[model samples]
Target chain A: MNLYGVRAIYKFEMARMRRTIMQSVLAPVITTSLYFVVFGSAIGSRMGAIENISYGAYIIPGLVMLSLLMQSISNASFGIYMPKFSGTIYEVLSAPVSYAEIVLGYVGAAATKSVILGVIILITARFFVDYHVLHPFWMLSFLVLTAVTFSLFGFIIGIWADGFEKLQIVPMMVVTPLVFLGGTFYSIDMLPQVWQTISLFNPVVYLISGFRWAFYGVSDVHVGISVGMTVVFLAACMATVWWIFKTGYRLRS
Target chain B: MQPDISVKHLNKVYGGGFQALKDVNLEIYPGEIFALLGPNGAGKTTLISIICGIVNKTDGEIRAAGHNIVTDYRSAREAIGLVPQELHTDAFERVWDAVSFSRGLFGKPPKPSHIEKVLKDLSLWDKRNNRIMSLSGGMKRRVMIAKALSHEPRILFLDEPTAGVDVELRRDMWEMVRKLRENGTTIILTTHYIEEAEEMADRIGVIREGEIILVEEKNQLMSKLGKKELRLQLQNPLDKVPGELTLEPVELSEDGYELIYTFDAQEQQAGVARLLRTLGELDIEYRDLQTRESSLEEIFVGLVHE
Candidate 1:
């Protein structure tokens, strides 16, 4: 099954993360911490609690989701794209490993990185806001599922993109905007009735909602529906990645 | 004995409909150094890439070590390694780590001893910890070969292994190629240097415009197509040929100071003896006679031009 190949790619990617620790691990953690400083401490002091929870604590799930979705996509996209860019992809393609093993190695490492960062942000949140997970297992599950799903999606994007600018277009243009509008700092309920209805279409909303339910048992959308939506999205991403490899789209010629 | 690598009726037409390789059939014997010689855009790299599984073939079959390249790719690919033409490598990776990564990627268990041996063999042991970018061009080329060898494959494809390197490094690389062949690794290399092929290859294949026009043993090809020329320095100048040379035709120099006779390589002794007898009968006196044999470069150029 070329398990050694999978481990090679996984360990190679993990090594790259360690090499770029300042950008990969530290930068995201610092960004999340600043969100705490500005949005949690300074801003939450003026805003009243919504849904009987402190404003500082309520945003924890949303912030974690923000970093998770962003970091997962970026880490994974860059991880695969760099090989295509540097022409090292030839080695992987020509190796004895199958496409499945390649994906397992790359996406696994990226997802693992995102999960670690997500947890670090949670721990860092303790210094500023006293947050508690209403369901720890569910929280961890959601974190992992979201990271894996997004990493797969990022893998597709990495294969699709031919230019460095194309790599940034989806993450910056589509993902960041969705996360911001997905109720990262405020619930969709706080918006007008029409805006709240429109927010349901944003896929990130379901992820954040499911994650928020795991945190405080309060969410804009039902937990079951949120989980269902995430699973559907995950399936869609898996299919896309499978198709990319099967057709050798942008990979083999 | 069975072939280590067999390619039959292989064809490749890229996305834009430009055919890179025609219906090519080749069989590389186990433990032999086979060199593919071709001009630029002659499908040398494309052919290598297809066999290595980097480029998909449009049609035909390829097998490595009795395993089909596509249907039974794991076994097929596990038996082969490729060093591409370009110097493409992970610049940020240390030499040892990068080579080890290749071994693992090919599904082999980690072997530090094997990695160490490859490093020392390439004379890169001292630079194992240094980043690839820090190495000289020759060392980087060695690193590429090291990576290809990391998996200990039975078949190795070296595409232009000595391109852009200095003469001394080229010699070293050729020596390494010979050493690998001695270890029973079947090697198929694409190269522009015909002399290198003449020096090392057991057989040579000439590709032109996506087609392999000729493939034969190096010595056989030379003997069959080789042209031999003999020149005579006249003791005195003459205006034109005396026309008494009936067995063969001879060309007179413009100044009438020398005579040139071209003959088949296989009839070297007979052809030369007949020419000299005719010259003596014609009373053409010469001070010195010299023979020159056509090199592989000339033969290659002639084939490509034709």
Candidate 2:
């Protein structure tokens, strides 16, 4: 099983995180704090509740989702990419470890980091506004599932990217826009019928809706549909990762 | 006794249709230092990479420490440690952590005492807490060795171990190689530095253009191809060889001030005495004479050129 090898990779990544605490942990925490200050306190104080939930509390799950997605992708991608960049990947490839262990180590650590960040942000929301976990178990489950799924997706991005700019392109250009347009701030219900129908096409919509449902018990989409959508995306990422390792794409010659 | 490492019918063809190795067959016994010598693009690195399980081979069989490299990769890989030709390191990592990490990567349980001993042996104990990026090039090379040794593999492949290092570092590395061999570790090193092979290898294998042309005991290869040259400085110039010598006129150098005779080093005594007697019989007086032995470098050059 090469469990020691897996633990080595996991510890190495966690050490890297600790070494760059400011960039890894504090930066997102501070950035999300600003969102709390501006959107949750200042703007939401004037805005009315959208569906029996205060506007301040309504945005908590959405904001947590935004940070979770970005952080997970970056952590996992950068984790795998650094070895290739520094030419130390040969050590990992030559070790007595399986591809599954490799993925588990990198993705597991990345997911753990994002989940921790998600929890910290949720705690920070307590100071900004009041919110409750209508289903705490479901909330934690969604947090972990989303983190693991996105981290796997990020691992693929790391393998596919040839340059540093490519690493940033997808996360910034594709993900941020989808999260914004997928109703991170406002409900899609406020949009026209055609716009709401189009919103369903954005995968982030289901993720946010299911996560929001775990918090407020009210969601733009049914919780089961959102869960099903997230599971499908997770499986797709898993298949892609499996294929990448099987073919030795960008990893071996 | 069984071989410590063996490769049979190894062939590697890259995706672009470039064949890097062809029908390579080799066996390295336990507790021996075998040097693979070749020029650039001769598949030295590729051969080592495949045997270490880093690069996949198109066709072949390889066994390390009694385990097949592909079918039972985990144990095979665990039996070997590779110090690549290039100095690749995790720059931000501390020496202590990086060495321990390598040990763990081989599925070994944490053995701080072993890690400490490896670091101390490599003279890296004092720098254990320092980041790798802060070290000098030689120290980085040392750290690479430390990492490779941290796992205590039965076989070690040092690809160009002393390349691009200073004279002192090269000497230290040579000494270390001897010490490791004395410890009963089978070491396979690939290098173009003929002197390194001449100085370190118990057996030498020469690879040229993706093919292993020769492998022999160091002394045997030297004796088989070794040549000695004798040169004489004549007191007077000769337009030709005087046409009176028993040997051909090819022995005379241009301008005719000196004569050179190349012979087998092992039987040089008899040949040189007879040649000098003939020269005296011809009344060819010489002011000075010198003998030179061909180095391994010349033999290597000749083999590669052929």
Candidate 3:
């Protein structure tokens, strides 16, 4: 809980982030912009609006979600994996820095990257297609929550992963597919009744839906349910992360 | 005052029932250099890992500066510093950043002058700004020491600190370790080089097959267990030993030109003077003679063989 320990870890992680700014910070900004161009302008211009919103406006939440998901996973996973790979984990474990301090430092760094990217996409979306936030506070709330929750999930992934290839498995195979199928570009309502019901089980559906609700004051799923699911996930992920740190799972083992 | 470090009945059994340590007991006193020597896979690294809290012991009690390593880890860990055998560090981090960051890990307030003194003592001040990956192997080793000493721990464990190092660097490191001890830090070193123990250890412990074969003060261990030899040079090449020489414990050289008689110097009657008289009675011609004293290496080899 000491801020000094947190600051030490934070500075170490940010230094790593700074070392690869092109990969961590800038790459996401550029990738999200491309999504705006191709999906928002080229694709959205031809297709009509969904739920009375423009095609450009419809994909903004999804794009933000995409960046947030990838960056959070990448940041946290790399943060933990690199230390293991480079053998610096020994130094950190031997230090007076507590497990909680280590987690906070890494998760905080991941959140920093994801949140910054989320904000950049939000600002960029304004240029492509003008949109008004029905509830700016809700928008900010979901943005911060999604960033923190996913970062924690990524932190868990980092702890669980043994090799570089394993680091990518969760985010690439699991998180990416969940984000794409969660109705980022299209609505689950457009599908048949059974498929829509099945899509309801994907946890990412709630995150995107909740963010969308924050934007236009309307969403496919109930806003309360989406928010509730996010809260549940945040708790689950934080608990799992804390347990890993407490048990010294892969770290001390 | 309590011992600087202590381990009682320490044991570790790996997953396939491979016992790495069995009923090991050891203590390191304050301001003394204790060397742990053993062949590979003899549990030197495992013992160190458990003491440093890097590896879990199957059953044991370990305390550093009166703090149990398992229950009171923070204080125990804070009381000691470890330099692992591997040269692992954040490759991208600058040398200064790496050392300073390691200090911060101990929750110590930043002190610029103390860090400067550490870097200077290790002769690493010039390379402080260089990235760790760019440093040479010897330089990297110094950085490891710098990082370990940054937190100002009372006890330091150096696991094979001189492996793969040149003689000069090895000597320099030994000197630095002595200086650290002079300043009131207890040092525990594990080395493959027996000479390091011979030259530096106040006490030595030898382990083999996950068991501590022997532990004793260096000079006492040598005198108590060390064997000495008298090498007799023949005045003329002997085709065979005289029948009277059979009564004595001696080894004939392959060429049959010299006789090697080994005996415990600590024994009351070494029989060396009698052997020479017998040689003279047999009219054995001798041109020269020399004495060979057993070294710690020979003692270590002897114990491990046992």
Candidate 4:
């Protein structure tokens, strides 16, 4: 109900992104662009087509997903964590804002930033490869959904972390490795039969697969299953956030 | 008139099983400066935090501006602004944006003129465009005050507003506080400085061991509990109090060179007259006599120790 409060927080967070444009927006965009140059141009030239699509075009969606997942988590986590660390969180908590509004403001802004970064990376990728979006609507939908879900996940990490080191632990140790092993540069279909079966268990595989399907209408898993898994994860993150606010966990004493 | 804030049977037990607040009750009248005096862990911050909706109470009810802080959180919180003890702000943010954003957080529409006035009042108008990190310590504290007043709430809670502040800023802050009171804002401040309470508080409340030991009008508490001391420079040294003066609250100085008489200030006339008459009749000569009224600091120490 407190739309003004939500807008204020959203604007404040977005402004922070502007202030740290090089770190927040430009770094990821440039890094993903380099991935296109290295992986798409250099490595793809030596590989055969994937699912009847050129190798360079094939990795575009995956590259964008890599950046999206990382950016979403890092942005959201750092957004909330900085406030906690600096103690300005008391200002927000003491205001008239509701818990839902606070989440919407922070997570929404984080997702917005990630989604913008994803789109920019996609544009940058276009210069290196000839990719087509078989379903542009679905591509956009998947982009937003992934950003929001991961941002929510990041929000949880931000709250659960008590120190700066803990903040980077999940993104650096768990998420980055998962994204790399989730077929960002290669298809799970190319893996050994047993490894492919095991790759199905890696959650990032579903996201990348579903996102790639939006680009070329082909995926390692059923697109429907990928979307369903994402929705399930989204619901779980929402439930966890609800519990955090209800119990005043970490946010209050 | 109904109190601006009413706390009933409040209790706060931390997750670690440390009881931070006992069954405490207090009512603060509207438009009055009330000072909560206590040491570091006396639960002054806890009580303010619970009322501000920042900390959850283990058991109790608090109503601000007639809204229950728990059930009607938004409304209750809208009526209150808190200047916390910690000096924390968005280091990257400009003063203008920080104060303006705080107002917006309370769901108030942006009013540039009002923000300008608040900035001017706090002597921060010139630094409105400056990043908070670039400001000095006193300037940052003023920025905090500006942010608290941005929403123009009816009630303001200043938790150690003058702690670590320079004397000049402290004086300015006190003057600003009085100006706010004139504007009809109810102010509740917690402080380690008893002189601050003595100077500004219309009513003073002392908290000790998570309980409110006393709350009374500042003048009344001073007069009731405040003792007057009479010091006599004796012509002759004495090892003990004279037997005739034993019934009075009298004691001999450790050096045995002076006689000290302690009495309630309310009975100043009769008590001093009788003491002087007794001294005259006993032939107890004194080269000098001095009378001193007990300060709020002494009274506070006495109550806390008791």
Query: What DockQ results do all the predictions give, each relative to the true complex?
Result: 0.93, 0.87, 0.67, 0.89
Estimate, for each residue in B239-299, the C-alpha lDDT of model 2 and write its tens digit: 7766656463238888899988888766637778878888898898999999898888898
Q: Per-prediction TM-score of chain B?
A: 0.98, 0.96, 0.96, 0.97
TM for every model, in the order presented, reads 0.99, 0.97, 0.96, 0.98
CAPRI-wise, candidate 3 is: medium
lDDT of 3 at B99: 91
- Fill in the DockQ of model 2: 0.87
What's the lDDT of the predicted structure labeled candidate 4?
A: 0.93
Steric clash pairs (candidate 1): none
**i-RMS, every candidate?**
0.6, 0.7, 1.5, 0.6
Candidate 1 residue lDDT tens string, B36-142 = 99999999999989888899999999999999999999999999989999888999999999999999999999999999999998899999999999999889999
Q: How far is B183's C-alpha from truth in model 2 (Å)? A: 0.8
Q: For each predicted model, how many residue pairs clash, with residues at least 3 apart or on different chains? A: 0, 0, 2, 0
Model 4: pairs clashing at backbone N, Cα or C within 3 Å = none
Off by over 4 Å in 4: B234-241, B254-257
Q: Across residues A179-239, which tens digit of lDDT does each residue of candidate 1 receive?
A: 9999888889999999999999999999999999999999999999988998999999989
Give model 4's docking category: high
Model 4 chain A lDDT-worst window of ten: A30-39
lDDT of each residue in A98-123, candidate 3, tens digit only: 77787888899888878888898788
Index of the highest-TM-score prediction: 1
Model 1 regions more than 4 Å off? none
On DockQ, the leading prediction is 1
